[model samples]
Target: MRIALNARILQAPRTGIGHYVAELSQALSCDAQLELDFFHGWGWSRQLPAAALPGYNKWTTLAKQVPGAYSLRRQLDQYRFTRGVSRHAADLYHEPSLWPLEFAGPMVMTLHDLTHVHYPQTQPRDRLAEIDRRVGPAVERARFILADSQFVANEIRQHYGVAAERIKVAPLGYAERFRPREAHALRACLAQFGLQPGGYLLCVGTLEPRKNLAQALRAHALLPEALRRRFPLLIAGMPGWRDANLAPELQKALASGAVRLLGYQPDEALAELLAGARMLLFPSLYEGFGLPVLEAMASGVPVLLTARTSLQEVAGPAGVYLEPGDDQGWCAAIQRLLGDQPEWQARRTVGLQRAQEFSWKRCASITASVYRQALE
Candidate 1:
């Protein structure tokens, strides 16, 4: 059957949803029974290679020089797809982002999280509205929906008044980049990135309000001075909006040598860093699924994640859990994880086992099944 995938998010770096689309698409393309067609918007776009596609290519160009044109270009792309989908007559169209609609065909949208729904304050009102408009239609028209986690599925059911039966829960997969590393190799990698081998508590994801990075810094500051020395907070993420005030506080923390902000870690370097870190601390306020928790566990690194939301779901028995907003809670958790080597090693073992349960190939296979279901 012919498949049209809404693969726009694959354009992102190694963040959660982006990684999901990029890896899973490559996996699905491996199946010879399926014919894959993908669409990309925004001029000057390029897709990284995914070998599974039997008959796959992109429609893009470098020249979109139309003046103040990004917005105009995006709208045009939307209209193009509105027209394109009807004529393409794809057996199914899979939208990777939330509320993936505005096309004329059997479509399936992947809702990554309920952050925008649960914490609308985390996203700009105007941007949320734009998303609401696009996704709103998709929710109503799509034959089925895909959610990265059950946490997000429930949110869709509640907010959109969509039944649970209409949505399928398919969690994202972990990358192989997250694997055990030699201590010497880990330090060598960090040295290249100007990262001290041991002076950090790592958190990887976009620097945004939902990530609760500001609160993480504050929690670290509240730690007793002696406890702070072994693990200075290290945040790795690209900057995102609705989080303007956050950067400055991170700046102050950086200036004081209390925090390290390594913006947009190159994938290989990030993999090494994940393997080398004292612990992966993810106290994000919310998530559709927690990719970092899986990454950390896969890397043989113990994790400290928020007890609430999907982090708990993703981390399962492999991680140490604490409340995201509880300053004292993070302080206590971080202290123990850093000081107790035996505890760390024990958790790492369980984490590795749990991490093994998720794989890109499985994600692809299940997604293909979802696609087939949509077609039926």
Candidate 2:
């Protein structure tokens, strides 16, 4: 079987979908029964592009400012994509993002979340409009749809009326690089950022409204002065849309040295960061699948997360759940976890056990099965 995958998401800095495309593609490539061609916007190749390209963000920011720039770019990309698909002679085309190009072949789409539909306020107007226009048609065209979790599969059925049979729940897997690291091994990397092993709390996600980071900031501020000084909150991700909403609490926390913003740590640095962390905090309002929770679990770090959506599914009984908007609750949970070493170690042990259940090889096997079923 031959497949052409839209790997264009890899052109920008990796968030969830970008990581999905990169990891899944590499795993799928190992299947000897299938041949894969990656379409990187302008052309097709057998190899995936680097995780991110230089100046890609600058180019995208500039493109958004010019009128009709996105439309023109899309048209050109579609033309190139159509031509590439013909030459590759693909049996199927997979779109790992919300927008799928015009492809007539058997289509498999990965709907990571319904964030745009559920929380339209979280998205940019133009981008939301584009997704609104294209997603319904794309869903109708696809022979099979892959969702990151059962929560998302249910959302698809509820919102789009996509049948359960046609939607497959293919959970994401963490890379081998996310495993636990010894303190000695993490010393050099952590030293670069002035971090100490097991000395700080971690919140890993893009800064945006949907991440509910302002509440986290408030909750962290509620910590006792000495506790705050000892274990500061560390946020690791790039600035995303509507991040200004977090400014008030963010500024206050930064002033007191109770929180540090480490914008966009690279993939190479993530394992060490996770390893050295006292715990990972993810209070996302919604998620298709909480990859960071899984990665943190795999790194032998306990996680504190919102008990909703796929976060509960991913974390299972291993996570410490907190209400999204309950700053007081969050503060209490943090205090309890820090003070209780036995409970913390127990959570870490279960987290590691839970992480063992998921792997990219399993995800790829399931995805390959979906492809074969689509062909049938």
Candidate 3:
């Protein structure tokens, strides 16, 4: 079997879909019966350079600033890249994200989430429009679809009218590096950010409306002054598209030294950062799988995630769930998680056990089965 994968997402720092593509590709490459070809670039661009550029998004943002650049790139990918896919002579093309680049072969697309459909307000108008136009056609063309969670699979079925038989739920896998780290081993990395093991709360996600950071700030501020001083909130993410306002209240909390924003921590430091944190604050309004929650659990850290969306499926009984907009509830949960060591330890143990259930090897095996089905 031969497969050509849309590996362009790997050019940027490994976020949700990027992580999926990279990990699955690596795991799939190990399969003796399958030949894997990674298509790292599209349109006029044929491949990514040997070096991994850490700030690839900066260039992408700059390109988007140029009027009509987005449409031109899409056109080139649609027209020119179709030929590239043909040249690979792939038995199947797997797009790890929503949009597939004009492949006529049996294509499988992973629709991670319908956030654009559920919460259109979370994305920019132009981007929403683009998704509306492109995603529908992509769905129509794909022989099969992959969903990160059952929550998203149902969304696709209901909203896009995709047949239930056509969509498969392929849960994400966390890297081995995300497991627990010793305090001394992580001391040097933690010290750079003024973080002490089990001393500070952490939030990891792109700063945007869907992440619900505003409510998190409010909840953090609701903490008693002594608690706030004892454990500050550390945010680690790059700014994503949205008008998720940093309200005056959050600004006040930030100014008072209860919050610190560490934008876009590199992958090398991610394991240490996650392990050192007291708890992962991920009160996302929505998610497909909530990878950070899993990573945190795997790191032996308790997570406070929203009860809504696909979070419950990933977190299971291991997570501490709260309503997305319940600042008071969030504050109380944080206090208990930090102050009560026994409870924290219990959650931590359960989380580690739960995290063990997922692996990229298993993901690859399932994916290969899907490819066979697609080919059939």
Candidate 4:
């Protein structure tokens, strides 16, 4: 089968969706029966000049200032990239993001989440409008839909009225790079960030409202002063919309240097960074599937995630779940992890075993099956 995948997400630095595209593309390409083409819509540009490739953090801010920017980009992508897809006459096109462009062949779309629909204010107004206009129609048109988790599958059917039979659940996977590494082997890189193995608390995600970073920061701030000092909070990812609207306690925590924002580390460094952390803190308000939680578990780190959206589905028995507003409860849980070695060790062991259940190869196989089903 010939498959054309929307690879536009790869133009920027990888976040959850970008990693999904990159890893899944590589795995899908390995299939003997499949001929795969990645469509990034670079628009006749031979190569992006070094200066033009801005960092992910800067790109996020730039992408928001212009209204209809995404709609315009997709139109251009349709004009330029679709011609080649037409020439190839691919059997199916897989969109790893929420929506698909106009295509004559059968289409498959991966719906990562409905965060914009549920928490509209958390998204930029223009982007939210664009998603509202495009995603629903695309869901209706798709031959088959791929969801990141069962929770997301239900959300699509309930909210968009997509038929349950047409939607397939294909959980996302962690890359080989997200595994645990020896402390000594990773010490030098960890030292660059002043992070010691099993010492600092880590939070990985864009600095967005839906990630509920403000609340996580508050909970970390409320940690006993001694614990806060010992397990400094480290945040990794680029800023998202309205990131400046932090709570007073979160602001104080940031000012006091108890919370460090290490913006958008490269994917290569993530596993080592995750391995060095004492525990992963992910109190997201909602998620399609919490990739960071799985990454942390895969790295053999105990994780504390909110029991929101699809997180519990992904975390299973490996996560310490809490309500997003439970500052006192979150702090108490952190205290136990800090003080109780036996509890930490048990969770870490369970996390590693659970992490084994997911992989990019498995995700690709299921995705491939979805493509075939779409053709039928």
TM-score of each: 0.87, 0.98, 0.94, 0.94
Model 4 residue runs over 4 Å out of place are: 43-63
- Pairs in clash, predicted candidate 1: 29-52, 99-135, 101-138
58-140, model 3: which lDDT tens digit per residue? Answer: 76776657665566667765665577667767889888875677766798989999888777876545556677888999998
Clashes per candidate, residues 3 or more apart or on different chains = 3, 0, 0, 0
Question: For all the candidates, what are their Cα RMSDs to the real structure?
Answer: 4.9, 1.1, 2.2, 2.6
For candidate 2, write residues 195-218 as lDDT tens digits: 789999999999988888787788
Judging by lDDT against the true structure, name the best candidate: 2
lDDT of 1 at 143: 78
lDDT (C-alpha, whole model) for all candidates: 0.74, 0.89, 0.83, 0.84
- Which scores higher on lDDT, 1 or 2? 2
lDDT accuracy of residue 323 in candidate 2? 86
Ordered from best to worst lDDT, the candidate numbers read 2, 4, 3, 1
Pairs in clash, predicted candidate 2 = none
Local lDDT at 190 for model 3: 86
Task: Output the worst ten-in-a-row residue range by lDDT, candidate 1.
Answer: 55-64
- Which pairs of residues clash in candidate 4, taking residues 3 or more apart in a chain or in different chains? none
Candidate with best TM-score: 2
